[model samples]
Target: MTSLWHRRRQPDDVPTPVAVAVSDFCRRAKAAATPTEVREALALLADEDDFRVRSLTDTEPERSPLGPFAVVDILRGTAPELASQRQGCGYYEVVRELARVREEKAPPAPAPTGLTFAAPPAAPSPSSETPPEGSTARAGKSARQAAETLQSRIAPRRREPLAETEPYEAEESVSFKRALPKPRGRFTQVAAPKASYQTLLHVEGKGILESALAQNEHRFALLKSLSEQYNGAKGELGLPDLEGALQRHELMDRLTSRERQGLLAAYTEQRGAAGRVAWSLGLSPSELQRLVSMLQLQAEVEGVRERFQREALGTRHLTQRLDLLGRDKYLADLGIKKRFTEMLRKEMEDLARGELPDAVDLPGLCLAIARKHGAPQELVLRALERLGLSEGLRKQLLAHSNHSSP
Candidate 1:
């Protein structure tokens, strides 16, 4: 009876008893993945000793190596280990293989497309200036001192936006309007070539120093060489021949993309800044900017005047012609508008520079200045009214006019 029972249980057909049990477990696991997929994975337990046999979930490091377990116990279904692995990254290959072994009855998957991507470039690291070598090591937080040192050196009047070389605190707000110091000579500055060369060498290291000086000198020399260039081209458009255009192009192309932008920005800033300096010394950028504009306007006016005379047009007609060239509804209005715009740009520059524009139309200029300075427009108007400043006197007020006490 025992031999008959053994034969009934051990019929030799498809699967062995052990394999059948495993396949059955896998089939049941496929329903909801018997928590064994999370079990330390085959890859985690994969080893070199292929001939060495071992049961699944056995910690046979000499044979399979590593853990034969995942976060949770398969039979119990609790994963305390995975909670500790939150910081680890994923490896989808192991997860896919596990799923495949468990769900064999499912249809085959489509071939995958291969994709490759490069990592992005890293940001520039902060420049660390090691303070004089053997001196007592400075506190890490002393970056404020370095920032103050830098501010005292080059950035105040250059009107540069401040950024630090190291970690630093935010700059506290201060009144932008301050009284101008007593004027010396021309508000315009003429940087001595030799002195400028020295300044460049001192500020920038040897690499850019000579190059920057050479670039500046080249521009200056180009202007000198093409003395007749600004006279307007002789070929109908009044444009100059620009004989040194090649030199300018070469100089510009030699600069890096960033350097070119910085150079142009600096020049524009300097142009506006010089005008403001002139304003602080009792002149206006409007007059300077307008001088160039008016020079062209003068020729246009003269030509139109001749045309009007030859055609026997009325005075109103000539004035209208000027207005048309200037693009104003009325000639007189055009003049006024040009003057106002010129003055506004001038005053705007002044608000940025150390001084303010003189009080012309106190309320109007004040509002313009206020807008430039990011202050309330009505506040400036109200202040002007309270001060009882005459139109002419108001015109005398500098951009500093906003600061009541100062």
Candidate 2:
């Protein structure tokens, strides 16, 4: 009797159910001769619902071998790896061999029209005469080559069945063909022209600056005229600069003493209206009203002047500032303060270039920004709301974010 350590069980000749099903799926996929047939096969094997087949087909068109290979890869966990071993063969050859192997393993059907396939020819020895290109010897060589390719897709070791009837108990033997390399000719994005971004910033900056500068010039002139008029009127009327004199504490003390002795009058006591006050001061009402107007106009000039300064800020400087602000907000939402200005600039360009479509991926845009800056999920959701995103899109993005969360 064999020693326990040296004892080994024999491999099962029968194929497992998994092997049969996988082989069947591959054969069906290969046999699909027309576009309609291919589609039907895809509908059957490729997932149709929530559990989608994550295949190359998602990226590559169904017309290409890459798509079918992707479908096969999903069906058999090791199919892509096994197929990768066929370094010398084309994708179509690998698929053809898979179908041939399946047909060989299947039970034979009854002969139609009372005809049957002939017996295979004998192998030619080296001493024999060379066979013609279309001869049986050449055909046999082709079949042998196909078998070799098929062998590459099988498990390396012989596996014993878990039970007498369960052929694949040890290893999954029914893996499909190798995964194909990505197909060529898929549409690729053409990079946007670099000048376009610069031009956009330039145009926007120029428009804002021109408007601010125009307003600033107009306001500055108005302020100058008001100042000159107010000065001339004060001198002509011989009015004490009342606002300036009142700034001293000693002036208020003297005024209080004069009021106690009834030697001076208070402006506050003559508050019937501006017209009456002008008459009391022995001044034209229009001149007094112009002084009041000049003071009010001075307040607005300062604010408008500041607006001109801000508008005159450089485009590149403004862009960088805005980009930094977004980055800082995103980072702070995650309680971080690290610098990532370069990455934020790239993300900003992506948005400005319309890389993130508003209708389809508004939420994705927000989440991408948040993710790049390590923002919290709550922050991303709040950002979407702030953008005035539609309810349906918000929900979709929320679900996507939740699903993508660690």
Across 105-152, the per-residue lDDT of candidate 1 in tens digits comes to: 444455444332323333333674544443323433354466556555
Against the true structure, candidate 1 reaches a TM-score of: 0.15
**Candidate 1 whole-model C-alpha lDDT, 0 to 1:** 0.34
The window of 10 residues in a row where model 1 has the poorest summed lDDT is 1-10
Candidate 2: clashing pairs of residues: 83-178
| Model 2 quality (TM-score) | 0.17
TM-score of each: 0.15, 0.17
How well is each residue in 219-282 modelled by candidate 2, as lDDT tens digits? 2222332333233223321223322322222333443333222211212333123344446544
Best by TM-score: 2
Q: How many backbone clashes does candidate 1 have?
A: 13
lDDT of 2: 0.38
